[model samples]
Target: MTAASRQMKLGAFLWATGHHIAAWRHPKAYVTAGIDIDHYIQLARTAEAAKFDMVFCEDAAGLREANVAIASQTSRSIGFEPISLLSALAVQTSRIGLVSTASTSYNEPYGLARTFLSLDHLSGGRAGWNLVTSASPIEAANFGSTGLRPHADRYERAREFAEVVTGLWRGNPDGAPGHDGQSFSVRDPLDLPRSPQGAPVLVQAGASDVGRDLAARTADVVFTAAQTFEEAKAFYDDLKGRLAAYGREPDDIKIMPGVAPVVAETAAQAQEKYEELQELIPDDVGVALLSSYLSIADLWRYPIDGPLPELPPSEGMQSRQALVIEQSRRDNLSIRQLARHFAGARGHWRIVGTAAEIADELQARFEGGAADGFNVMPSFFPGELDAFATLVVPELQRRGLFRKDYEGRTLRDHLGLKRPM
Candidate 1:
């Protein structure tokens, strides 16, 4: 299909409460949704009703924040394990895909493969794995490591781990298969038969150089955090370009950037909503969150309105650090200003507008060849998700930019992605 004709695939990136850092603090958002199965079921059904290609759940092996000070202040300390949550969500909704995040740094290939394979079967072929190399040092500690693994080493292990997982997914038709890889040695074949769509879709959300290469080589869907059209296009072009070298076609992988959009009846109302959420974030909380995200020196040391001093070197989240720094320099934002800015989408594109306006932004990106689609990160849950489904989705449908209804049963079918042999 041509770019304009290709339907924009949509995935609801469901975070606890919402994508905004202070989303839980919002009056309309349910603060305890992280542990509430009913809340997730409602969200899933809502997205399914809107014909979303998938409902994505992000995970971290350890507490996301650095310390009890930040962790206690933040609402992110609590959440369900992704695989278990998605497995339960599978029974609650049909047609809408269930995509869950897991870390290669902490999980073994065999266990991950088995769990996802079972989820695909349980969901009737609507499961996707968002493969991530755990970035937090806290995650490493949970796995008995003293510190974060080197970036290159982590991706190396990930490459091998993914290979083993896919190899196991392609279990022998006649005989058992064995895999001996640098990271894992699997002597026994997977006992599970292929699910309806053959295997769970492979999704990756890494933007660093090593991460991008890994995504190009293995990801069926690439989730990204692109802030601008130029950045998105650059990433899209770079990723699609790498597919040829891997003996993969351009269409083999889909790039879906994370976009957190706030929708309302009018432009003013949307801006008001966006600002309201931003205002809820305490300066200290926002700055701390920004510091952790960029993994640079604590910005609290610098004056809130003063020019950002030289960023300290970071061995953590290089691409994100660059993105944040570039944005700060480009906009000449103060420390407090950048904190509030990051609070909304945590560096993902945050669009505040009406339904038609949101649709316009999505269509522009899709038609501009900056994105195949987007993983929509609503600023707040239930409320924001409902608004998008009720307001924005129809506009997209009207413009023929999105599907009116699910055309097929499997996730691959929803995304128009080919099943692997």
Candidate 2:
């Protein structure tokens, strides 16, 4: 079927606290949930209840924080390893796609391939890989390195790594026994049978130029944070155009942006709920972190309400840093407001309204060629996500905007994506 023919796909981007920076601080969401396997289990089941295509988990290679960032930072660190957690979920939940992020910069390709291959087998093809070339400085030191890898260079390495991984999978047929044994080098392949999909679906999330090229070559799905119609359509057109160069079709890669919704019965209630959640952010900390991400020194150098600081020439984190600064400048957001906004990656796109209203925004993007689907990060999870599943999902189903029930068992099936051989 053509892109125009398929219904829009939906995947929930699950964080330990549930997307909002202070989600765990919420009254209903389990603050202790990040470390608990049951938290993810509940989340996966919730998503399946909504007929969402998958549940995606973002991972980082290095430790984020020891005490504060570590203890409270369920997202960047200190959660069950994604594949392991998802493996457990595979036994409990049947339909939702399980996506795990693994960085190409810090990991060995052979190891990652084997692990995800095992997950694919275990989940019966409900597995998807969210490929990331991590952009954190803190992660470098933990790996016995002092500096972050160059951005473009990371993508270059990722392209090669993907080639090797997929090549390893190329020999294995779906549900058939086979092995290359590059890591173990054992010619006999008897441990586990071949996975149902042959290989896990490849998903990538980077808007960088180098990132885009790698996605065109290796990814079955590409994720971005663009939310607006014009931006989404432009990216969709540009990416689809590039696929032919890789000897692939435009339909081969699907583009999705992140969406965070705060839904209530009334628009006023939704906005109020979002603001209430916003109040929990730490102002000074956000300013410091945001400034450092853009490589600016002393965010305290500027007033809380002052203009965003100009960043230095790009060393490695180029367009990414510029985007944040430029967004700050364009919106004229203060540090406090910015922090609250980033409570859920503020710039990604926030839908504040009733379920019908939120559905309208989603439909607009899909019809406008802005998205093949969305990476939904809820504002306050478990409860907020529960609201989404209970209230908003039916509205989407009413409009034929999302799945009323899962069509197929595997992640690829839910996305209307064919498994790549």
Indicate which candidate wins on lDDT: 1
lDDT of 2 by residue, 1-421 (tens): 7554567878888877767766766677777666788877888899988888888888876565433543343344566777788889988888888888988777866677778878888788888888888667767767888786677667777777777667666544443333333222223323445568756889998777777888888898887876457767878888888899999887778788888899999999998887777676666556655655565556667778766656567555565565676667768888656655654564577788999899999998888777888888887668888999999889988887776777687777777666665
Question: What value of lDDT does candidate 2 attain over all alpha carbons?
Answer: 0.74
Give candidate 1's TM-score.
0.98
| Candidate models: Cα lDDT each | 0.89, 0.74
Candidate 1 at 284: error in angstroms? 0.9
C-alpha-based local distance difference test score of model 1 = 0.89
Give the clash count for each candidate.
0, 0
Q: Output the worst ten-in-a-row residue range by lDDT, candidate 1.
A: 172-181
